[model samples]
Target: MRGFGDLEAEIMDRLWSWGRAATAREIVDDLQLRRPLAYTTVTTVADILHTKGWLRREKVGRAWVYEPTCTREAYTAQLMHQALETTSDRAGALLHFVDRMSGDEASALRAALEQVKERDTP
Candidate 1:
């Protein structure tokens, strides 16, 4: 899967941050605080996101409420996986990636690896 476009990323960021369903009008209003955006434009983009399977929508009263189909973390992981798939040497790429991580991030990676190892042990 590909990453979100500019407008798509804005909408997704708001929905993921709120952690709740929202209508296009609500999103437009929130985004308006940062920059001018038309309600119709936001609605169209939101509809596109729904068609792309990045969002799920339900008709509530007269408005359609939209929510993210997956968390931001899931999207980031998918992007990372996609990046790895493009590399000829995945291990070398991963090593370079790890080398750029902060101490806390490195520790977290180590902890996560240990958890996966434990889970895979039979």
Candidate 2:
């Protein structure tokens, strides 16, 4: 899977933060706070994300509203899996990654693993 470009990431961040479908105009207005961006530019990027299957769009009134197809957690997990695939020793890489996690993150990882274990144990 292709990674997101700078603009794509920014747009996705806004959509995720908004937690709902948003129009190109709304996204442009929100993004303009950080940098000057044209409405068409945002629209083009949103369309690209839709083409990439990272976002879904619907016709709301005369405008297209876009929202993430998956949650942020799912995206993060995909990235982690991709990173792991790059290494020959997946177990060592994961151990090193776990060693670097903060206390809270480690606890969350443990809990998430337990939940997965329980779900898999038919």
Highest lDDT scorer: 1
Q: What stretches of model 2 exceed 4 Å from their correct place?
A: none
In angstroms, what RMSD does candidate 1 have relative to the true structure?
0.8
Against the true structure, candidate 2 has what lDDT? Answer: 0.93
Lowest summed-lDDT stretch of 10 residues in model 2?
1-10
Candidates in order, TM-scores: namely: 0.97, 0.96
**Which digits, one per residue and each the tens of the lDDT, describe model 2 over residues 34-88?**
8999899999989999999999999988999999999988998999889989999
Per-candidate clash tally: 0, 0
Evaluate model 1: give its lDDT. 0.97
Error of 1 at 51 (Å): 0.5
Q: Model 1: per-residue lDDT, tens digit, 1-69?
A: 888999999999999999999999999999999999999999999999999999999999999999999
